[model samples]
Target: MAGHGDSFVDCGCSVVGQAGGEAAATAQRRVLARTASVCPVCLGPAPAERVAVGDAVLLVKRCPEHGEFSAPVWRGEPAFTGWVRPKIPTARRGPGTERALGCPNDCGLCPDHGQHTCTLLIEVTQRCNLRCPVCFASAGQGGGRAKGLEGLGGELGGRPGDERHEGDTRASRREDDPTLGELVARLAVLRPRAGDANIQLSGGEPTLRDDLPQLITAVRGLGYPFVQLNTNGLRLAREKGYAARLAAAGLDSVFLQFDGPDDAATARLRGLPLHADKVRAVEACAAAGLGVVLVCTVARGVNDHCLGDIVRFGLARVPVVRGAHFQPVSFFGRYEGFGAPSGASESAPGVATAGTDDRADDRKLDDLREAARITLPEVMRAVRDQTGGLIPLAHLHPPGCEHAQCSFSGTFMAHEDGRLEPAGGACCGTGGSGGAARDAGTGGMAPEPIPAALGAERARSFVRRQWRAPDPATVSADTDGARGGTLATPPRDDFERFLARAGRRFSVSGMAFQDAWTLDTERLRGCCIHVAAPDGRMVPFCAWNLTSVDGRPLHRNGAPSRTGVAGCGGLGSGEGAGA
Candidate 1:
């Protein structure tokens, strides 16, 4: 593996010490694009550039006081320049806040932000039942003040008097879970601002709250069409009727934390052997007619080898398991013992230990870090390799809704005999008369380029239809609507035949989140996932979870105080709610 700034010649020789000093090494690098990022040490805005070195693309930035920092953003196959889906930047309908500070710092969905809310995450609580070592929110713990905002006070984007004093009541208030009335008020404020965005009730573990059924009912009552739960699945597995109760309460989908097929992977990542419990949870969801999407946190050298197995497991479950979603591990929140350097005892359990070498320098340490970090292209190739071409590289397409670099998705129709056929319109080619090209999956003409706004709207509809449990009434109407159970008019065409088995559709997608080391303000501005803040504002997902190297948050615990805006008050002081 190559380090962050390492460069080499075609003949594979190191060119760092050949006598031209620093300028010689700098000449070998090719600058790709200029953007803005924040320093991992200080959380201050800095100018950054994407540069290609060897086969990797690194995001390199320098803070005047903190010096230079570099991290690999893309590496190997599918080529960075070729994996682009250009979008006509569409701003939000009504700006939530003024542009006071800058891009990420002024994130009240300021007028300059370039995307609408595809999914609005409302964290119902900051408490959890399990203490997983890889939590992004650092949940199930108490930390009143935002460490990243310490001392800077109002200068860091809050109002003049918004700074917290030593004995302020807000600090203690941070520990209390929001009451039901408070959540209803928050939903009323969000219903107008978010306008038709999908709702996800996230938490330390949302199941920990006894009123979760009530919360789901409340969300649906406010006219949000879809409601999903992000959970670990312990309660759903152990409590017999829990899944049915949630389904009856108007819940549509379950984003279950299912790491892999067996205990070997779960014990290493989740601190216990939970494969059996996860299976039972899925079965329970199936029994209750609730659709489930298996969510896996892909960590390099740990569960990276388990992607194919996870996909196979989901496929075996068919309509009950709607999809498999993989997320590359980002260095933030609670990933303490996982990414340590070579020879450290704090390495995650069951991982192979590296031999001790006192001669390891900063560059060698950086190589280890880069090796631990996995890129989106690498994951795509891994899926191709691990699944033996069941999912080919050509079938996977750049996301139509988000920045092309953020994700890749493919839809497949599963057969009863365990074969997957790529559905048409999976790829979003460039849009216009000239944009039509050959469809890689079917050798036919492909769909034209999709505008960003239209792409987002279609994506929301697709998720609602595919990820929700099949409606019994609609299924009966399609399969047995005729008298005496005969087809009304036989099958007209192959397209109608395909629609007959629509319940078998399955999706495979991966999302690469940005951490302090990988944050690119360009990608941040195009983000479609937004978090609804207690202060009656919407913040982009990445900006809300941005934290320094030492776990100090930028916006999670430090949102501005709530104003007297109608239906926006009384949201409790709990911090960092969503996954």
Candidate 2:
């Protein structure tokens, strides 16, 4: 009865819904509509339809060469059809490519592509220290296969791609990694076009690069409003000064890979008992004035149960731990299995792409169903159940910049006793000089979906004001030495004091990336997260990770060209790219 027209709720204004009872009944019976898709097996174009299966929506399509396929794209109470946010169409221009290869291949934000760039993900390397059972990037030792080594698969035990020869280590892969100058130039390209786009430094552990601080400083100098570091936090825990160096270099946020709260969860996902180390990493970041967003790769039977606990943990940390982001596993890259076996030992076969029983381990993307994966509605339901219903359904808002069904966000105010209240409407606390319309509280109403132009500024402000944690001096003394970091600092400055007052409010948000099986061109048209490619073009993040049936990645264009930097020499970022 309290329903209102807002981003979170669809007004009963649809032509069919508002039509006569007879018309409405007929509309309800209409279960199929056309869309577009890609065959997971061949990565070929396929005509698709949205078929209503009970309350869930299934994308059913057929490829000339790959046969028929269907995957669950949406589900839950209201039905997927009614969950769409009003479309906000931006100006469309011709794509950078000549339109030779079509929808995905014309990926230089091709003319047919629907959206402008929102968040630019700049991958710095293909090397990683740890090898996980499920890795989308296939990031491990030896720069993840040579330039064009495709179709190398067998089973667990051998190298990542199951290549006969041992791949290059992190040290051996440095020459191909993007340099600071090249990254700066890439950002320069986005400045005039995308305009103040948020840049996230990602790849086989961005922190592994010793010159990260230098890179962060370089990124900031180029006038990018927000610079985020995506890392596993292993380096942050071991190197006490690492977080501080990043902060001093103008790093705005750390997207830390936090699978769950226990050592077992860490070992299952990351192949090590990293719970203690994750905590230390959070503490180090908090002490050094860096905001952290816990990024949990949510596997259904894996660490999905810990979603609520992860949110509570983040709320307890307040301004420092800004949010917890949950990503339902999208079967892409080198992912081997759906869920880890119970009591998975350290020596247990990982979910690597190189599994011998390829059919048993690798999910044929074409055969994927709604039951095979977790959906956003399911995740929200789990979070609500975990928190005892304190997290209101209305608090989840349709994304302002991305596809409505792609993601949802909720903002909350943290209490000293660990209770979290939705920060909107009647409960929204008094605020400062910031815009009240954009305030956390709007009477529990969802904020209107914003266009790309406005979304960028709003994103920058949110990261600066809400993501940055409160001054350490104002935190409860009981949390001291909890993470064992040496970057603690004395509180100083009026700005810090002012931010402390506004820091209690933080946000929880996530985006479900579409893999090849769920590749809908409609969703692609609305994508805002773009991966910066070496060809000086921006490819949608999902498209970049989408792989062909033969295991060839769509947009992984290799390392960008270096500018005036010295040749890649010396022992770079000491993490061995060994499995």
Write the residue-wise lDDT of candidate 2 on 426-545 in tens digits: 111111111122233433333344454454345555555656555555543334344211224433677654444456676777668888667787788778778877667888888778
Clashes of each: 1, 15
lDDT of 1 by residue, 156-232 (tens): 12234433222111221234778887887887887877778888888667787789899899889999999999988
Error of 1 at 375 (Å): 0.8
As a whole number from 0 to 100, the lDDT of residue 384 in candidate 1 is 77
Shift of residue 486 alpha carbon in model 2, Å: 14
Q: How accurate is candidate 2 locally (lDDT)?
A: 0.60
The TM-scores, one per candidate, come to 0.79, 0.76
Cα displacement (Å) at residue 288, model 1: 0.9
